[model samples]
Target: MAQTAGVKPMAIAGRVALERERCLGMTDAERAWRKQWLKDQVLAANEPVHVEEYWKERINPIRRFYRKPLDVLFDKLTPMLGASRAADYRVITGKLGLIAVGVMAIHYYFKYHGNDWTKKGGWRVTRSKPMVLPGQPGFPYKSERSKDSDYADRGYSKSSLFDGK
Candidate 1:
């Protein structure tokens, strides 16, 4: 399993050692009683954990907003793969998962960015006014706009069409 995941055995053993050490008042005899069993437990805990839990936590809740055609296949997979293979599957599926998450984030961003669903719809990246917190500077908005009018038209992103010299 470690080989499949590209994790060295020594690293796994090191983690197991750390786990064993974290147990307060654990005597050497008890600690060594079943090192292999303890190691296995720690190893399992360190992995992505059972696959069903991963799907429930990461995927299923978003079903209302986003449903994919392959979701049915993914949902039925645990019956064949079993929970033990879930961690490995998580590693294997990580790239595809990342792409899916990225796409979803982009979708949400474009969908909610302008508050288009609301009555007042304007394409604003952020509110122009700053929410004042106690002890912070007043209306201290972050901007790349130049303090000087001369430099304003000199910058790379010349969004403004003004030619004031």
Candidate 2:
């Protein structure tokens, strides 16, 4: 490093202290100018790279390949469906969701209530086990000789459900 004309040689610690004092003493405008000058110097030292153009060049072929079929489909449907409705994602999503839900509901109804519509007795809904309420015989625990051994069959059935464990 070149020495200043009027500056005296000093230890590294003394130089650091001097720099800290000088930085603390600078005005807001001087600090801002100094920051900008340093940034400009850093920018000037590095070569510029066109990141957006580079990425676009790399991705253009893949995008074009995938988009052609979709574009053609859109073009064909635009006039028939009305351009606005054809392009509206919300409407398409809502209709698709409704159809999916209807299909699932029909499937579950057949699964739970048998698909035998021509039967004499008609469809019968499958029954689930009854829920045991608080203060009931099997409120949170089952007795050793309980008629239903659903819970008692398991070795650790004495655990209290109310205790959150």
Query: Which candidate leads in TM-score?
Result: 2
- Writing each residue's lDDT as its tens digit, candidate 2 over 1-165 gives 456666876543332235776666877766676667556556543466558678667778787685556557766888888878766743565568679999998888766655233343535554456678898887775444545543323323444543422
Model 2 residue runs over 4 Å out of place are 1-59, 89-133, 136-138, 141-165
lDDT of 1 by residue, 1-165 (tens): 465598544444443356546465566665575476565665554575568766667765567344453445455776788755754575567668779999998888767664332335545444354576767886455555556553423232343543555
Report the CA-based lDDT of candidate 2 relative to the real structure: 0.60
The C-alpha TM-scores of every prediction are: 0.22, 0.23
Report lDDT per candidate: 0.57, 0.60
Say which candidate scores most in lDDT: 2
Q: In model 1, which regions exceed 4 Å deviation?
A: 1-83, 86-123, 133-136, 139-157
What TM value does model 2 have?
Answer: 0.23
For model 2, the run of ten residues with the poorest summed lDDT: 150-159
